[model samples]
Every structure is written in structure tokens, then in C-alpha cells.
Target: MQPIFRVQSNLLYQRLEDALQQGLELRLVTQGDRFCGVPIALDEEFIEILYLHVSEDEDSPEEDPYARTVWVIRIAEILAVAYQQSWSRDKLAQLLPTDAATSEVEES
Candidate 1:
């Protein structure tokens, strides 16, 4: 079956499309009180995010690269899908999260 992918924000959806077309990766950063990051992985229940963490000048080592932090977001928390794409079955199967509803449907 074809898989459905969705992004919640129009701006973020645009950025993701641009990044994919340009062969570039998006970096998630902190903006005032908000946090932004790319969606690296997802499952039926959670989305795994990888965001850059810059250490304070006082705490950062002279040559240290930025750190990456992984955050798990609940699928229910996602507002909507800003963009959708059809993915190969193999790829979709690998990335799609497994959940009780899905399991029940598959079993029946």
C-alpha cells in the first residue's frame, strides 16, 4: 500500500521540500521560546527528532562541534500533515509507526 506522510506547518513543509530538492539537511534550532528541528524518524506513536545544541561560549570546548539531541514526539501531538508523499512499501513499512489500531486492522 502507498504510505501517507504529512507535515504540520506550511513553513516547515516548505523548508523540508527545499532541503530534499537541494540535497541538504535542515538543522533545528531554538528560537526565543520555540524549538525547531528536522523530523529524522517516526513510528506509529512517536516522531524522533534530531536538533542541534550549541553550548554556551563559557561551557563549549574550543573545537567542539554542536551536539545533537534526540526528542520523541507523540503522533497525536502533531497538528496536521502539511505535506504528503507516497513512499515505497518497503520504505513506508520501515518508517511507519506500529500501533494497536494498525495491529488490529492487520490481524483482522
Candidate 2:
């Protein structure tokens, strides 16, 4: 038998779309852990985000390289979603265009 999935509300979809449009950082909670990233795209079944990773080489612990990854996550696995209103916001601000960043600052 096929597993049943809960019907997600339109409000949730709208929020996700807004996040994708505005380059907002989001935190997603799944059954196992939490993930934080900027949304790239989404459909009924899944959402994609650019996940940033910083790794340090064991031999050179002082140097940490930054990596960006596209993470496609199943919509069904998302238990909850929230705006990352802390350091992530600051980090995303750095990634946005200067004009956009200035506009956001002016708006705020």
C-alpha cells in the first residue's frame, strides 16, 4: 500500500515561494535533524536550497574552506520550517547584491 501524506496548506507554499524570491534563509526541521539554507526552488514534492559548508583539513586546522551545495529535500520529510533570524541573516545579507542589501537595510 502507498503511504499517506498530510495535505500541506497553501500558506506554507506561499511562504516558501516568498523565501525563494527574497533569498531569505530558512531553517528546516526533519525527523532526524535541522538544516539551514537559502531556498532555490520548490514543487509539491520537494524543495532545493543552497547549503553552505565550511570544512577544515585535519592537517591544517587553521584553514577552513567554504563550499556551496545544492540540497534537494523531500517535502514530506520537513516537520517544520522557520526563518533563520540570527547569524544566518547576516551571512545571507553578505551574499545578496549590494543594491538589494542596501534596500533591505533602508526598508528596515
| TM-score of model 2 vs. true structure | 0.58
lDDT per residue for candidate 2 within 1-108, as digits (tens), equals 442344365566667778888899989889998888999988777889888878767676644488887888887788888884445767878989989988988898
Residue-level error in angstroms, candidate 1, position 52: 1.5
> Which of the numbered candidates is closest to the native, going by highest lDDT?
2
Candidate 1: residue 84 Cα off by (Å): 15
Best by TM-score: 2
Task: Give all candidates' CA lDDT scores.
Answer: 0.54, 0.79
**Pairs in clash, predicted candidate 1:** 7-82, 43-97, 44-97
Q: What TM-score would each prediction reach against the true structure?
A: 0.35, 0.58
Residues 30-85, model 1: lDDT tens digits: 33223345567645455556678777787656687578877765544544433335
Error of 1 at 10 (Å): 15
Runs in model 1 with CA error above 4 Å? 1-34, 54-65, 80-108
